[model samples]
Target: MVKEPAVTLHLTRIGPSWMDPITNFLENGKLPDDEKEDKALRREAAKYAIIQGQLFKKGLSHPLLKCLHPDQTDYVLREVHEGCCGHHIGGRALVITRFSISEVVVSDNGTQFTNKKFTEFLTGLGIKQKFSSVEHPQTNGQVEAANKVVLLGLKKRLAKKKGAWADELASVL
Candidate 1:
């Protein structure tokens, strides 16, 4: 515990969620054509509808790549996205409604976990962040499943189309 990592890596990729449009439809109360839709906006929107975290894994992974040094931090908080995606509260809340609000959440020190502002948000909101054992991915089962579904949806939709995966994701997802 004496040696601190310079940067703790938490990697996650958010492509597209097929259920995005559905949620938009429900939220917006109106529909727009493809040309009128916002790709960047929708991609971010997907995060909200399907914002599930890996069972025991941190949510954000982008910060992992920006390793200023290999050894600096006292610990590693491996997560995907710290503020929104890493937490996975939206997705859990969607399914469980009031159940997950009362469940215990354990986590290791990923970037999302170590963030001061994020921690303060969790504390103010009364959300729990617990650190589990290292490398035990099974804890993040919901995230794994969610990632798989997104990947599968992307493949199934774009497989028959003629365009870039990212480009086609809005329509498919």
Candidate 2:
């Protein structure tokens, strides 16, 4: 009997520090005696959140240019596909990701994945792309769970150096 390839989902996200201040303010209302400083922090955090939300709405999420260049993305996808599929050319593998434009380009109006080059790249590598359902995270529950595990591990490993997530990613992984 032929065994099926093991399916895997790669998950990535912006660091927690980017959203912590906003979440703290949301839950606690405001900070004591430092209203002006707290307000500024909250505003900056909210701005970042809004920008991220807009990007998500436009089918663009993690693995941004700063995180991974398009060429690097192609390389990583190829490596992961081959490694997970026993290095078989034309082996079938499915990749599930948020509607990140870095992974999949949506049309100008956000109606569809309109990037022919990306589609062709996947086709060439015998890989299939699936986007998590809008507002339904259960579709990618395993990956989500894995993300939490990684974050927890990183939190413990990094301690107070939160901004060093990228630097410590290799050890975390």
Give TM-scores for every candidate, taking all chains together and pairing residue i with residue i: 0.23, 0.20
Error of 1 at 76 (Å): 57
Over the stretch 34-119, how does candidate 1's per-residue lDDT look in tens digits?
65475545544444431222111113642222222223222243433453246655765677564445234455455644677646
Tell me the spans in candidate 1 whose CA falls farther than 4 Å from its real position: 1-100, 135-173
Per lDDT, the best of the predicted structures is 1
Candidate 1: global Cα-lDDT? 0.48
What is the Å distance of residue 152 in model 1 from its true position? Answer: 15
Q: How does candidate 2 score on lDDT?
A: 0.46
Q: Report how far residue 64 has shifted in candidate 1, in Å.
A: 49
Model 2 lowest lDDT segment of ten: 105-114
Stretch of 10 with least lDDT, candidate 1: 49-58
Over the stretch 1-173, how does candidate 2's per-residue lDDT look in tens digits? 74752443355654444344554555555553587877687665443323322221112554322223233456567766666555654423323332333343221212223355545544655656665555655545754565567558756666655554344343433
Q: CA lDDT of each candidate? A: 0.48, 0.46
